[model samples]
Target: MANEIFICHNCPMTRTMATIGTKWKPIIIYTIGLKQQRFGLIHAKMGLISKKILTEQLKELEEDGIVKREAFREMPPRVEYTLTDKGLELLPILNLLTEWNSRHHQADFK
Candidate 1:
């Protein structure tokens, strides 16, 4: 378990947490999750994210091996981002986190 961290519990949940536990990572992971989407698509979907921050965060996720990047060689070129198999595994966890946030926080996006 690389980067495994356990806190306040008996099991090692921190490694899982490390993947999507941060402020923007989980949001990004959850956004381009099911389908491979372009940077503009993700940016449009995530209203609050700025271009600079989005670029930085995407690079970080790419470095962490949780996200995959695909680029095309054509006029005007296109690049898309998608979750790796490891990143896909976090969907259910993100769903649970969203649920908990809804119940406890009351319209987190609002």
Candidate 2:
């Protein structure tokens, strides 16, 4: 038989983690937030992520169907990213994780 794509231990949660478990992926998603964001603006907001890494991460997110990337044909050229329906589904989960972290580390959170 063909190799099973996911064993019993590797389930949907594991798949989700595989998709967004990177150190920067979640932060990227949160930074994008509710509105579409341009590449330069996102880089400015993130500050720490190098341009190369950000580009790679955005490509991955776009490939995974979690982020939509649109390019405009204009003089300088422009691109924007927004969360897809699948990505929007993750917002509540990310919020809950934030709430949990705040609850556990009350001193650090405001």
Candidate 3:
């Protein structure tokens, strides 16, 4: 027991951050919203993010069970991304954070 690592394995915050703690993860989740969106649409919504980075983030979110990827065997190989139930649960929290920032970060707006 003495040599066991203290990595906050049981901490909810730590686990949450581990799942969606990157600059784009939360934004990506928010962007996906309640409907499915294609990779191009998500990329279009977030114009500043590189395609490579967006692909990587989406893959991570899918792996973490926060996002669902649906690939179709169609002519153009259509792929869409949608938020899973676990990801939907984070929307309200993200909204609260947005409100908090709006109220508290007025100076930053300028």
Counted clashes in each candidate structure: 0, 0, 0
Instruction: Please give, for residues 30-96, the per-residue lDDT of candidate 3 as tens digits.
Output: 8998989999999999899999999999999999999999999999899999999999999999999
Residue runs of model 1 more than 4 Å from their true location after superposition? 1-21, 105-110
Task: Report lDDT (CA) for all predictions.
Answer: 0.84, 0.92, 0.91
Per-residue lDDT of 101 in model 2: 87
**Which residue pairs in candidate 3 collide?**
none
Give the worst 10-residue stretch by lDDT in candidate 3.
Answer: 1-10
Q: Which residue segments of model 2 deviate by more than 4 Å? A: 1-9, 107-110
For residues 46-105, what per-residue lDDT tens digits would candidate 2 score against the true structure?
999999999999999999999999999987999999999999888888999889988889
- Candidate 1: tens digits of C-alpha lDDT, residues 1-110: 44343333445466556645668888999999899999989999999999899998999889888899999997789889999998899889889978988887866555
lDDT score, residue 98, model 2? 88
Arrange candidates by lDDT, highest first: which order? 2, 3, 1
